[model samples]
Target chain A: MAKGSVVAIDIDVSRRLGDRVIAAHFTTGPGLTALFGPSGAGKTSILNMVAGLLRPDRGHIRIGERTLFDGATNLPPEARRVGYVFQDGRLFPHRRVRANLLYGHDLAPPANRWMSLDEAARFLGIDHLLGRWPQSLSGGEAQRVAIGRALLAGPEILLMDEPLSSLDAARRGDIMAVIERIRDELKLPILYVSHDRAEVDRLATQIAEIGE
Target chain B: MLSPEEWGIVALSLKVGGVAVLATLPVAFGLAWILARYRFPGRVVLDALVHLPLVLPPVVTGWLLLIAFGPLGPAGRWLESWFGMTLMFRWTGAALAAAIMALPLMVRAMRLSIEGIDRRLEGAARTLGAGRWHAFRTISLPLALPGVLAALVLGFARSIGEFGATITFVSNIPGETRTLPLAIYSALQVPGGEAMVTRLALLSVALSLGALVLSEWLVRRTHGERQRRGD
Candidate 1:
């Protein structure tokens, strides 16, 4: 574990999907901890548990000194203050990029907000696309906006679930560079999920192999 | 081309229909949201109750409404004592009956739209720090707007066409409760009243057709918008 680790989690959770039971248990003291595994390895489920979108049957999740979930307490997603970048850029279809990016920023308390909308937009190179709708943007641009939206919420930790899988090679490279900046520049803790070993090797500071 | 009396009837019909729709819109949306989002023990029963007005005889629905909302009944007595209001043989009673008749259609339209929304988007909103109500207000509700508008229009059309319920609940008193359908019915009863009945009936058909066309157009426009956006 790195000195003054940003996140620590040990959780056990399972859910039944038809005949299959998907389950995950992991403990990490992290920089950017990547859960590397195959498609059905329950990596996303672990992230969901960390973000409070899923409940763990046992164990606990802690960010710094704050307990997000344990045997007795489970914070809801909104209260957990986690920035989540989904596989698909789940931007609001009705909103333009500016509003999508600002949605979380405005909901965040002023004392907790770390970056201005313009700063985050410029950092993600999405400042030019603010007026455009999510549907009008290419997959890459939309993903970048998704990241900026998450970051502007001033989360203690970020969760990225195979955010590069849908992009072309060139776009993947661009987003990988952005992820590097997030890890190095902002130094935000991240729990990333990916099946691609090469991607994990390049981006993750600590890799936790999930499943077989 | 209507005489002043005929025009008055049309205006009255519009008033009752408009009020009925406006009054029912929030309640219908609430019910639709609940039905679309949750799975409770008696969800099916609640759903069936909402649809009861549609399947039951309109007169029966009206009779139930009369029992509940009459001046001497529980709700009616409370309302009379508290607000000094009565739905008894008044235009307001006609509006109430029309609204009840229209509720099922409104709820169905809104419920389908609410259910069709990608709940994942709401999850994303929550991860972005929006509370449940905030996510619903800003995300889910806007996405469901076209359906809500369609519901309102459909409910309005249904309200104007409501005759059996309105007459059963409030009776057909001219000016007070005689809407388009009731006016046509009244005209049909008099000697040499065919011309008046024909005019009112044509107006009724025209209004209902216009509403249905508008509702269809709204639904189609939403689909076209979604497709064009490649959603």
Candidate 2:
């Protein structure tokens, strides 16, 4: 595949769970590319490979001009400059919400930093909740904090791994609205993983259906 | 009340134990991090080596320390030649013996705490552009602190009560290597030394018991905090 888009994931990654084979080979462009698949279909695995959390068994993942992973050059996760919002809202428990949100900011190079902590907090509507620890936040509030955290790093790309999977239906829309605002306001590429068809139908600009 | 000489014994014990633990804490934390987070070749062997003191006879452990730390020994020779520091038959030697005997307990407590931290938090930090050291400093180290504190207390308790290793490695020398346990034993060797032994034993019991209770309370507080956070 040509290294043309702002983000590219034309790679083959396979995971064997006892007897089942969950494999993916897909590419995405500038906008939101949703990996829609059933449970255990390895949607998150693909995202992990892109984020440099898991090295792909074959093929390559290129974001902008930098190749994150391939045969020899498997860039470490910290160097990937890709913000990830995990489904479970993996906030640092000991840290206050403000600290969690600002964690990525210190490491992002001045050139890559497109936003500040205050801006992220304002955009995510998390200004009032900054002083509290993560354990106290509601699901929707936690997800918002997680998003703000990823965004503060000023990543060129964002990866949402079933970000709303753990939330109740009532809170899902609140987070969805925040995600939409993020997409509309930011110029970064996004790879959203989800099992919900309706969510993909609503937010995804491109769809790659994984699993045989 | 402890007699003047008895008071000296108690003071020496506290000083030796405190210095040993304080001296070894940073090294213990480094080892704990390695043991808890990494899987390298001979990992099992390294684990066994670290816990050897816990399973081995303290006298045997002291013998090992002596072999490595005596003035004629290679390590001891180098240390003595370079820094004028001799760790045999000195009060410093007793502290060294105490630290070695107590190391496993300290490392174990800290390692358990380090392992308990949600590794994904470090992963998250990494994705945010934080390097390994930065992630460890800001996330893993802070999260593992209570356990580290508990480890220090446990090490101190073990240090103060260290007997076999202290006796064998440094020997019981007053104003030098004779700590509380050695003093107790020396008192027992004489006829009218019962009262001295009794007072020293009671102090030892109190110190050990206090350390254990403090460690237990810290562990429980950490657990309670986790539960409160719904983690």
Candidate 3:
């Protein structure tokens, strides 16, 4: 493993969903690491563990020099500073787009807030949607807002859990462009989960196959 | 179209109902959240205890309250000695009875809404750097608002209609504990007070109907919001 790696995850965790036991174990380093696997292959579970949303029954997670989880320490999700864009954009229904974008931004400490709400909205091309409600936005538009919301939180690493899976082909291309810009311009490390071979090949600097 | 005395009864009813709902709101939400989110030992018993007042006879509930909160009882004695307060035969005691009776309905409504909320949204909030309490307050609480409002209205309606328990526990003091139902019952005891009884009963009916309608509207609104969100 490179000492300068953006994220280091060597985790073994199993979750019982009904009678099926979904378990995962993998490790990746630096830049954009793609977890490629079919559906129900526990790809999202890995992203969840990285984000501290799911605990590993064993092993450890390290992002940069900080130890997120291990036998001796387990940091909660809020303290982990991981930006997650879910398959379904989980925007708060009660808040307007602007409020949703700023929800995490406001909670992040002043020094950690690298992006302003305006900058994020403009970057995601959601500036006109500030006054709109989450329920009214299109699927693609909602995902952009979700991305912007996550970025404004100033996370140490981004976790995209099949974010493009729910969009149309055109919208997928558009979001893929956005992700490419994020990879190149912002240099933010992303742990992307996708089964799309083309998407993984196009966006990933390192690929880790799961359940192969 | 009521006299000053009748108006006083309406005011007292509103006060008691409002206070009962307000006081019970936090306790109901807490219990509802617990019931909705966690599976733990004695959960069934806790749930049953919450619903006990709903099933128990109003008079029995009143008797229990009197025993527990009366001047001679342990809680009653503690309140009297420590806080220089008394509940026996007072409006506060009437409000307490109303709160207890209204609790189960409030908790049931709140729990349903809380349970209906997607836990994933809370997880999203957590990944956004919100602590558990912060995420719950901003996400789960707002999502559950309509249900909570409906619960409050339902509880208020139940409190205003509280009759047997209020009468048995507080004995329907003229101005203090004589809410709408109690006043109507009191009017029935007097000869030629049938006219007053009829007027008060009609008012009670209207109040309850309005609350029911409002609660129904709130519940529908919640469903509509959820549907629009594609949930």
Structural similarity to truth (TM-score) of each candidate:
0.91, 0.90, 0.92
Return the TM-score for candidate 2, rounded to 2 decimals: 0.90
lDDT of 2 by residue, B114-230 (tens): 999999888888899988899889998889988898998999999999999988999989989999889989989999999888998999999899999998998888767865764
Residue B89 in model 2: shift from native, Å? 0.8
**Candidates sorted on DockQ, descending:** 1, 2, 3
Encode model 1's per-residue lDDT on B1-231: one tens digit a residue: 899999999999999999999999999999999999899999999999999999999999989988999877899999999999999999999999999999999999999999989999999999999999999899999999989999999999999999999999999999899999999999989999999999998898899999999999999888678557543
For residue B71, what is the lDDT in candidate 2?
82
Candidate 2 total steric clashes: 0
Candidate 3 lands at a TM-score of 0.92
Each predicted complex: what DockQ?
0.56, 0.54, 0.54
Q: Is 2 or 3 the stronger prediction by TM-score?
A: 3
C-alpha DockQ for predicted model 2: 0.54
| lDDT of all predictions | 0.89, 0.86, 0.88
Model 3, range B1-231, lDDT digits (tens) per residue?
899999999999999999999999999999999999999999999999999999999999999988988889899999999999999988899999999999999999999999889999999999999999999899998889988999999999999999888888999798999999888888999999999999999999999999999999988887786567543
Candidate 1 C-alpha lDDT tens digits along A1-212: 11233566555566555665667666666568898777887889888888888776667777777888877888999998899999998999888899999999999998788889878988999888988878889999999999999998888889999999999999999999999888888878888998888898999998777663
| Runs of candidate 1 exceeding 4 Å displacement | A1-30, B71-74, B77-84, B226-231
Query: What lDDT, from 0 to 1, does candidate 1 have?
Result: 0.89
In the order shown, the candidates' Cα RMSDs to the true structure are 3.0, 3.6, 3.2
